[model samples]
Target: MHNRLHLTYANQSDQEYLSIYGKAKITENRQKVDDLWSSFLKVWFSGKDDPNLALLCVTIEDAYYWDQKNNKAVTIFKMAKAAITGEKSDTSDKGTLNI
Candidate 1:
């Protein structure tokens, strides 16, 4: 039963990931988001196992390059995390925010 629940959660996560990826892929600027994501991973989180990083990266791409309204939310979330952890966000580094 425990394994079954874990499997279900994994499946749902994969579906959500695919949904986000599909949204980006179908956009007029499809390759831009993917390229930015690849650079982000290479620079900041290479070989890390954090599953939600893709979602965060996609959110950043949409908010910044696509002029989406979610930038405030992302900024607040990052600020909150930094406040709690007392560490500056690596995402603020030069070229990391480029799309």
Candidate 2:
């Protein structure tokens, strides 16, 4: 495990619309979510350099969106489990579990 990890949202030009919508902070928060996942991938796969252990990307749609960040966490956990146990992830309906 990494001793110290930093996460910050990287802003995009399109997010400027947030200001017009009075949702700048909300947009920034979503960027943080993306950053957190990116950071985790960096650490989780560090030093392994194994093609068999590559990380997979999972997409979550608004249809299942929730205020809590559990969606990402669940997807990550299920993927990890599937990799370790050599069984399909229970949380995902599709082969990759469209979280």
Candidate 3:
């Protein structure tokens, strides 16, 4: 089974909690929440082998960006793994970690 993870971005205002967690939990600026969701989707869905995973970003702005490739499943996977492992994966200078 694929592992799922939830990451939270720090410095989130009280308002940002609802969207990240739920309405009963808290809320945040609409635009900021949307941007955070967008970033998570960009990685979670774009990756191939779409493994079962969850990335809960608190700030979302910390997300790294590489060149706009047609599809960046490989890149996304590397980033996820790095996040989980707390160390950079075997990647070239450009951060392309060959799985």
* Highest lDDT model number: 3
Candidate 1 lDDT over residue span 2-82, tens digit each:
211111112332222111111222233435545555554756665334343443222223111112223556757877899
Off by over 4 Å in 2: 1-70, 93-99
TM-score, model 1 to reference = 0.21
Model 1 global lDDT (CA atoms, 0 to 1): 0.37
Local accuracy of candidate 3 as per-residue lDDT tens digits, 1-99: 322333333323321211122112234445554455545566547532234433333332123213323235665787789999998865323222222
The lowest-lDDT stretch of 10 consecutive residues in candidate 2 is 16-25
Q: What is every candidate's alpha-carbon RMSD to the true fold?
A: 16.9, 19.1, 17.0
Q: Which residue pairs in candidate 3 have backbone atoms (N, alpha carbon, C) closer than 3 angstroms, thus clashing?
A: 7-56, 9-58, 15-27, 15-28, 16-27, 16-28, 18-26, 18-27
Per-model TM-score versus the true fold:
0.21, 0.23, 0.21
**Order of models, best lDDT first:** 3, 2, 1
> TM-score winner among the candidates?
2
The deviation in Å at residue 75 for candidate 1 is: 0.9
- Candidate 1 residue 91 Cα shift, in angstroms, is 5.3
Which clashing pairs does model 2 show? Answer: 60-99
